[model samples]
Target: MRPNKRDELVSKALNVFYRSGFHATGMDTLVKETGISKTSIYKHFRTKDDLIIAVLRLRDENFRSWLFSRMAALSDAPAGQLLAMFTALGEWFGKPEFAGCMFIKASAEFQNRAHPVYQQSTEHKQMLLEHFTGLAKAAGASDPAGLARQLLTLKEGAIVLAAMSVTPDPAGDARYTARMLLQPYLAGG
Candidate 1:
């Protein structure tokens, strides 16, 4: 089935926001990039924040789907699947269109905790944390929550370093660190 005008708009806006930041890309830019008039955009979204939330929801769905599927494909066991996250990150970082973490950018642009955009960004991270926690439990980690938070931190750091070009192989470095972190949980450390 074809996407409706609102979905199409959100998709287009997501691209624009990914390329340009949330605050930098104004309504005019959105209209120009999305090729949808302000009147029509407002018809679907009461405000730009509402549109951003919609875009974030789409991103959350797409990103989590891709990451989890890649993890599962890369490793059958839960322990390996946790490490596979870095492999998946390497693939994503290598993409020509890679522009760092959208949720990170969103949170930076929308710093106020009360802001819906910021809350949405927080929600994205929370979901990832929950997934990591579940995987840690499945992997038989002694401290599932601790391991999950550590992995999430490593993942986020790798993303930041990659985006900033701070390291030539942040993903490789992160994967190595992740291996060490997962050592005790593995069958034979």
Candidate 2:
């Protein structure tokens, strides 16, 4: 089925944003990439920032769905799922088009805390941290919040390292570290 103009614009905008970033990708470029007229684009989104926010929202939904589904497929145990999350990251890193975290990039570019893009990016990251915190709690961590923070650090660090290099498997390293940190929380430890 053919996508509506709005969906098509958002889909194309996401690709362009992923490749050229929100700040760098111009409206003219979006017009060319999406093959949508400026008037039409403006009709759907009042401004480029609005379109960027839409793109970020799309990314947040898609990324979370992928990660959660991937983690679910790996294991049922909370501790196992926490450790296995890196396996999902590894799969993402292995993708040829991997270009680091979009939310991270957005937050970096949209520095103002009150900015919508920045807020969306912050929310995306916060969601990930909370998700990890939930897993830590379910896994019976002695200090669930601390473990969540530690695990989130490992996860984000791995993302940065993986994005920087094409060789070394940062996800594998993160998984190992997560396992070590989660040891006490696991049933046998």
Instruction: Tell me the tens digit of each residue's lDDT in model 2 across 1-189.
Output: 656889888988899999888878889998998889999999999989999999999999999989988998998889888888999999999998899999999999999999999999989988988998899899898888899889889989999999889459999999989889988766665
The root-mean-square deviation over C-alpha atoms between each candidate and the true structure, in angstroms, is 1.3, 1.6
Per-residue lDDT over 84-103 for candidate 1, one digit per residue giving the tens place of the 0 to 100 score: 99999999999999999999
Q: Flag regions of model 1 displaced more than 4 Å.
A: 187-189
Estimate candidate 2's alpha-carbon lDDT, on a 0 to 1 scale. Answer: 0.90
- Which candidate tops TM-score? 1
- Model 2 error, position 123 (Å): 0.7
The Cα local distance difference test for each model comes to: 0.93, 0.90
* Ten-residue stretch with the least lDDT total in model 1: 180-189
- TM-score of model 1 vs. true structure: 0.96
Model 1, residue 46: distance off in Å is: 0.5
